[model samples]
Target: MSSAMFARDVPFERSPTTDLPVLLPPRPRERFGWPKLTTRHALLFAALVLVAAGAAFAQAPDAPPAPASEALTTAPATPLSVVVKWAPLLLKGFIFNIVISVAAMTLGTITGLMLGLGQISQNTIVRRLSWFFTQFFRNSPWLVLLFFAMFMIPFQVRIFGTTIPLPDWMKAIVGFALPVMANVSELLRGAIRSIPSGQWEAAESLAFSRTKTIWQIILPQCVKRMLPPWMNLYSLITMATVLASIVGVGEMLTLTAQVHAAEGGRPELFAPLYGFAGLCFFLYCYPISKLTQRLERRYNVKT
Candidate 1:
């Protein structure tokens, strides 16, 4: 057969015996580095290296000696030993941080969705108000907002003559949620606008109402576009949970501080303890970031 006869549209090769076109196998995806070295394995390896380094630093003979008072009162313990001893308590505090992040994200997403819809509303007042709020919270410093919530908001409220006390962490959630809501509002608005104008025209041509078109058509498409960024935002929120330590929320960092103080405020323990806290956050958020990258690639639009 001539080469012209083999120039077919389908991706296939001819089988010698049957003279039939055999379908080609899919191309293998390219992977960087070693085949068995996954992200999890790399992270675990890095953690081990960090632990080993910290141990070496702690036990180094050339390290500074403890103060006379501290040395006399408390027996010296290895950094790893101290960390292991308090791991349970530190972990409990870390769980609280996760809870705070989750609650804030949920509350923020709900409010943000409504606010986002408002930004594109036909009503002038609604659109302007939504825009204003979105800008206001989005631009404000997160730390300032957190501080405002802590001091300005009351510790309790009387509703229907029922006295309900508000805790510090609850206020912290509200503080964190405000910025999250604003950012999400902006995210939603941007995602909605990214859809081609032709889609709107097509939906209108079908006699689909604005609300129906948005809910049924535009939003479904936007979900994939929004997911990666939304997840990235959640990772940021999770890491920011450490800021709660400043306000005495008893998160991991705060507990770590308490542990340090309880352990005689040993200068040597400072780096390892804080480093461990950071590693916890890294392990948690790094996976989220990697997953976000994978999703972004998967859902990427060629156009």
Candidate 2:
């Protein structure tokens, strides 16, 4: 039958459960409000109410003034109003965080894919080497390398007995890039494995070349699967931009700290400065998060 061939057996039941007699609890109005109040109890209730009113009236004239800190608040604030006094610097700091994250992502993705492909390679040496690099970074401390990159890379970056002529920012980039690339590579490799093996065979049967198979077939499928994790990695990197602050780059959080310190240790003065940092992070990240959700729906992937 066509039903047997295509339609699934409707094992599900449709009849609703039989409704039983409802034994609802009584309402508060159904309960006695002032059950069995004696003359003394009635007098006590009235006396307490009068005492409360008299206390409120007595305190009205004696209420203390608001403190300077509480009185100075100007709420219903615009975001620009938070740092309009130093708008140029705050804007520059916000822009730099975005730029650094994009640069790190771009550098990280290209090298990561190559490393990931190598990690899954048939050759023992390539596999072992790739595995070792990925394991080292993934297991090691990110903060440690951050410091080493900013501080020690200067001495160790020499080429052929001469120090490498790269800027501090470049050193920071290189330092930040390695661990991220290693993680990205492993993430890609895992994602690729999750795709059915028949996909690879089908690509080959179509006479697609090795690079074509990877770029055209293998990668896009892998990307859909990897979309959620990729969004997470991007989110992680956006927060990781704060690491550059320790190396002297004045991104949002760093700028907030600097502002806080400059204002005589008054955390209140620049607390919203940190809020602005969080706001920038939200604006930068929320769109990609939404896109990741859409991609997940399109692919019908569980994760």
Candidate 3:
């Protein structure tokens, strides 16, 4: 055959009849919009487990009790024996501690309310004086102030009667309360300030006096805000009773100290004494703390 005939016979032709769907790789299709867990994620998971393990490993192994610090080591008192013999005495101290907390909380609350009002009072003089009182009491250490009140106040014959023989418990009550008053005062003051100015204006427009507006409108709002702080203050008051122990007030802590002295500082006896004392502290404060937290959440919604 000729070359042209061969070329004609070996023909190349193109046709258009496509109807197939485009396909992607299975790797991307299998994911279906899911994110890939990279090496970073695996490393993060490993690091978290390591951190937890390291934390557990870091704690020192507890050793057997040393004899030197044994409670009642030198004729130290035993826990069981102290419970049998001295429970009643310790209970009296516990009651005194409760009394101090109650008295201080109630009186301090009243004083705090007054100071809170003083902060917003129209009288500049009253406000200035209130500020000074709040600053002084809030900043001063309770122990120093109490010592001064108990031992030094008599020299000046300033407030409490000069000839009066104040009980150790009472002295502590007043001294600790002075600071708590300042604390509550500040809480109430902040709450009062937070109330919208529009509320006061509305009350005034309705012909209400300043005192009447506060009593009716402002106090309710302040009270709600005060609940958590007040409970916190109560806990502080409970702890503050420990200071009374130092002044020979015979509170729980003092009783525990007495037991400790009698125990000859044995770890077993002393540990349990202070442990029980610590437990008492928890008993008094824990419920209040829980209640405060609850009220905070509740009142936050209400306000």
* Per-prediction TM-score to the true structure, in the order listed: 0.82, 0.66, 0.69
Worst 10 residues of 3 by lDDT: 25-34
Q: Candidate 3: which stretches are off by over 4 Å? A: 1-78, 155-164, 264-267, 301-303
Q: Tens digits of per-residue lDDT for model 1 on 194-240? A: 99999999999999999999999988988998899999999999999
Clashes of each: 0, 0, 9
Instruction: Return the number of clashes found in candidate 1.
Output: 0
lDDT of 3: 0.74
TM-score of 1: 0.82
As a whole number from 0 to 100, the lDDT of residue 300 in candidate 1 is 93
Q: What is the lDDT of residue 131 in candidate 1?
A: 100
lDDT per residue for candidate 2 within 1-303, as digits (tens), equals: 954443343333333565333333544532212234479857865675455445434533332677768756733233235456555676678887777777877887888888999988889999999899888877777777777777776544567897667565676676677777888998998988888888899999999988888889988878777767777787787778778887777676677777656644533344355655665676567667666666556667553
Superior by lDDT: candidate 1 or candidate 3: 1
- Clashing residue pairs in candidate 1 (N, C-alpha, C atoms within 3 angstroms): none
Residue lDDT tens for model 3, 1-303: 675575565543333455432333344322122234579867865675455445433532444666766634644333556665867777777878898889988888889788978978889999999989998888999888778767854433335654555576677777777888899889988888888889999999999998899999989978888788888888987887788877777788887887767755544455445555665676567767767776777678333
